[model samples]
Target: MNLINKKVTHKRFGMGSIVKQNDSIVEINFATDNKKFVYPDVFGEHLELHDASIAHSLHQIIQEKVLEQKEEEMKKEEEIKLQRKYQELRLGHEKLMRNHKLHPESQMVFWCDAEEQNSSLSEWKIFSGEIKSGNNKGKPNKPIRLHQNSAVLLTAVEPGRPEEDRRILGVYMVKDGFIGKLCEDGYIPAHSEYRLQLTEQESDQMLFWNYYVNEKFPQKQTWNTGKYRYFDNSWMAQILRDIVALKNDTREQEQAQQFFDHHCKMNQLIEQDLPKPNGSLMRA
Candidate 1:
């Protein structure tokens, strides 16, 4: 915006006409002498344009800049909070690693069939299981294979893209015995722990093939056909480690905090407290 030759008023300088204008500075010709001031900065506080239309336009621009600055500050504060949470969680995870070992008495990896890339990563409140062999075979069933309080690492493969690589989506811990009913929706755990869901960026880095491959045929990925596969403590530990590494390498603090919050809860789990898998029946 050019202000050259425009009349202006300074609170102290009384009256003046803008003699020159530059990107950052504006000069004015006061009755007594010439004066210079910072552009825009002086308009709202130290000076005002004499023309009503131009003055209104400048006022709107100034208001917009102020609003943008406030938003930027708020964003910075939120990022700081996330960083603080991350540091606290990092310390907690270190203590857990030092004092405990992996427990997979019933831990398993679950694969969700999805078409959209982030379908499995959505705010999931229930998960469907498959009936291995029965009249209603391949239909949604309760998670009969999971023991109460066991950890389940969730993965996903887009439907019709079996040949493409899969991605690890999230993790969940089951609640006490079978709490779901025979409904079309799916099963619901009494509680989900370390309920971590990967962001799109995080999922890209956690390809299923990159972590778990067939032992005999190093080139082949495991869990080729099954919806769920039991994974031992070693596999569980590997997944946990990879998750921690991924969180540390990303700048998305809000997403990382969700993982850290639930991850710390995992430290409190005790193997003996978990119920043995007894193939309990779902509610009628």
Candidate 2:
């Protein structure tokens, strides 16, 4: 191939430009602090040219690459914007749900957890009771009014991770309503029990919880009083809307994957052109 001044990805050195070439050897300058010379015929196996659109002066190619990166960033920003918009719409719907009176038999419950163990929805279980009247007192004692098959949605905090890492864990159908009773051990306090059964078909794993907290439901104080928190219809409706948005963003997600794959290919070409510690060319 005609290798003079071409942008290529090296299997070892990452992205680089073919600065010079002779009858037997091709010279490449990598993005990293390395340069290499390789046999013209052998170089083809180890290096792949970038998109033909980048076939310009190194300076021009760099500029084009920067523009491409900016475009990708803009796409991500648009996704966030859409997420915020849907979140707002969900909140509004929630308010409407709250204003309307619910049937006396059914009530909605909100559940929150730190998810330190990264437990999946299937793994979650109904605990027997909580620690009684101590610093470790469990979820608050609110009136249990949920009917069988009532809705239960979960949100989780990702411990030691960024706030963005926090997400909605998904919805669970209450197989059994709150069965309030004291534990056999008096030291362990009584708690209202509910069997949270997962409905995988209706859940969204991509909806973030922190986004809702920051943009939709801002709280005045730290509200971590054990794993479960309760909310009414408005909050549940908002979560369902978020799920719908996530499911519908399939096209954007596919585009993102394509962008990421292109980036990886570029890096690999540059890396393949890197020189070894002994100042020898890496083998194809």
Candidate 3:
């Protein structure tokens, strides 16, 4: 119902809400800087649902900045931590070199297929009473914000669109009072999500890929020239190949990997999802 902090999420908006409802999109404030943003998209799953306490903690981490007087305190703590980590790495590297470890230069590099999402768990599971089987039921009647002076949690997705795939992640009470839900923690098919936090750049890549893939496919029966004109573009083709790889169909891993291999190579996976929006297709 409400978000106490400002967080970057995979939605059109980046901040969280304190009092949220279907029509109360204007009630949100971003923890990033105490600024406010409101829009039509805010009515959707602005954040994922998990636990309320964790969500509150995440909010505190984002909205509550370290005070100027506390800066030196944190700085000193960070300096000690860096010194320990650096020493550990240095000692390990020395041991490897001294022992004639044959590790390849390329082997030292790391590759992570997963992106990050920012999410939390819930304390209070808020929901609306059952609606008539066929009525619109309209939206929630209240501000949709939960009162949690305790722990909280939330869920979120990575920034990726049609062409790209992203995994979600969730965290615990990383900060303090947070409650979360998409449309007040209740939607037709809303699911509890876990999120992985990522940089803005990574988030941009995800959004770009999602748009490219969705516009080209849009969950249709097939991909055809009538629906997507850009599929014929060479750059699009190249990007897919560069970031995705192939695996045997029966030797499956996960949907994300499968998609990466298919379109990331040939854009073969989503061809069927693209169709004429008018619903006049051969299959139909």
The TM-scores, one per candidate, come to 0.42, 0.32, 0.17
* Model 3, span 1-284: residue lDDT tens: 34444343425445454443333243454555333335333322465324556556645544433354378788899999999999996776566434442111100000122321111122313223333335546444221222111111112233363223332121111111222221343421112321112234433342222222333444442322121121222223222232222222343324334433333232232533443222212122
Q: Please list the Cα RMSD from the true structure of every candidate, rounded to 1 decimal place.
A: 16.3, 29.6, 31.0
Q: Rank the candidates by TM-score, best first.
A: 1, 2, 3
Candidate 1 residues 107-156, lDDT tens each? 56666655422454455444566667969888886644444335567777
Best candidate (score: TM-score): 1
The segments of candidate 2 whose C-alpha lies over 4 angstroms from its true place after superposition are 1-120, 128-131, 134-143, 162-165, 176-221, 248-284
Q: What tens-digit string does per-residue lDDT give for candidate 2 at 1-284?
A: 36667778888888888887766677788876647564444344676677554333434544665698899999999999999999996776566444433433332333445442234354543332355686757644432444332344555544685444444554544433222221223111111232222233333354334223322225322344454444433334334434434554575445433432332242232323323221001110
Quick one: ranking by lDDT, best first?
A: 1, 2, 3
As a TM-score, model 1 comes out at 0.42
Q: How accurate locally is residue 145 in candidate 1, as Cα lDDT from 0 to 100?
A: 41
The runs of at least 3 residues in candidate 3 whose Cα sits more than 4 Å from the true structure, single-residue gaps closed, are 1-199, 208-255, 259-284
